[model samples]
Target: MTRCALQAGALYESTSITYTPECLDRLRKAFPGDFDDVDEAMRSFDPASAPAEMLSVLRSFTPARAALPGAAAYFHAKALEAIAALSMRPGPAAPKARREDRELVEQAEAVMSARLSERLTAESIAGELFVSRSRLCEAFRRVRGSGVAETLRKERMDAACRLLSAGGAHIADVARAVGYARSSSFDEAFRREFGCFPAQWRQDAV
Candidate 1:
């Protein structure tokens, strides 16, 4: 996921679970579709349909810097369970339909990721994507579980946090860098988003 796809200061770590050729083949059968690249594969997935167990695992996961003795086997078992659950989804899979839905959301996310430092509105983004404002909002809500504005705000706040952590930049500079028009406006929004003023957050970070 891009920085825009997660909450500010959130870090996602993927565990390395070794699988044999046979296991890899099985997973290939389960997911089935030739993806040109990792991004293509991810773009084809619908996060909304990810099973509750898988979601829970992802949400509660912590980085394992040192591998556990049975970790591979345990992860393999969970993978099989998740694949089984995903496979049981009713009706013949209309992959094309799902891909279309995923693509709409992915495209919007790509645009937002690329332009987070600019003043973006639903209308501006919709116009760039050649979709209506309502349609763009719907796609974001369906896929990202939030509206475009909310995503943009989070991204901006996260970026500000990173900048604050680094230390040295003036608040006004940080405000403009994240697309706010004025430091006072940035201070208000930052307080609302982060529960502290920028200066206080910077002090804590230092």
Candidate 2:
């Protein structure tokens, strides 16, 4: 796998993975319909960005197998998943800036999803990408049509809804899980986002 070339201060990390021919053959067999798409992905390879979750799986893998019984199979399955993920089609191509900006937006969203319980800030996320907060904000606005802060809240709210729908946890716990420091703040945001409080939403979901 080759990373796509991206703009300065792009959020997605750049890395490449290589698979043996056997691995590639397995991928073709696993996802026959997406075989052509995988070829296209390789042909149009970019060095700037890759699918983040898939790339992470690729990176996390160690060539050395675990001692456990199913370890070999597990690693093989993961390799297959990684390749299939790369094979999946991305959205329509945009201008350079737009494409890079969209990547930043996705990286920020992924951070929000992963760090929902932490008091993370856009500045912190931008710092990780070596980009200034203002630049990151500009990119987010251009790509997602929302400021980073709003996007963060939207992510947290979406997470909150999923937790609520799952039907467990106290309201306060749910609030914290989605990055709100206080239940009152969570309730207010949830009302604004969904036109009802979290408790009510849970009730309605049931």
Candidate 3:
């Protein structure tokens, strides 16, 4: 998992548990094609996305407990299970993710990051990159473990949250800036993502 401060004074907290090389090999074998080079994804994955059962099991373990006799094996197994779940790709396995796919994902990410204020779709992104939508989506899922549309929705929501937290833009303007043309639609989407309306979230954020 990763975290970024939204601004100069912003605070973001996160935690990560790196697997042993042995565990990584186990995960790679378990996930197969989609698990290659997962260490290099530019996009940050939230740990909250991990399976609840795995998280619960892993959470009950600690460094001291992991070192205890007999417990080490159990903890390592649970940790491996959690990472395997976290590494599962969204789409069906096609082939071992290619380095070219990494390049394509990077290009697509750069385009999406630069164009969040504009309406974007798989077709438009593929057109901009001169690649097929299937290739783009497949590459994106393999690299980021998420679909393009889902990732784009998250990008827009994240941008909106940053704007909301900084305290100047009106709700409707925030909506438009994040590519939603209709305030009502933006409001609905915002609530679906964050469980609150834009105005209410802004009030809490600032």
Task: Provide the clashing-pair count of each candidate structure.
Answer: 0, 9, 0
Alpha-carbon deviation at 186 in model 3, angstroms: 1.0
Highest lDDT against the true fold, candidate: 3
For each candidate, the alpha-carbon lDDT, in order, equals 0.62, 0.67, 0.69
Per-model TM-score, in order, reads 0.51, 0.51, 0.55
The order of the candidates by lDDT, greatest first, is 3, 2, 1
Candidate 1: tens digits of C-alpha lDDT, residues 1-206: 32236678988665322335576454433332111012222334465566586565454334361266677666657665554444332322322335555687788777767876676666677799898876766566556655566666777788889999999999998987887766877897788667999999999989
User: CA lDDT of 189 in candidate 2?
Assistant: 65
Candidate 1 segments exceeding 4 Å error: 1-97
Better of 2 and 3 by lDDT: 3
Ranking, TM-score, top scorer first: 3, 1, 2
lDDT of 3 at 95: 54
Index of the highest-TM-score prediction: 3
Per-residue CA lDDT of model 2 for 18-121, tens digit only, reads: 77677665543432222423443565666457678686776766545566678877877777667656655363443345778888878877877788787666
For candidate 3, which ten residues in a row score worst on lDDT?
33-42
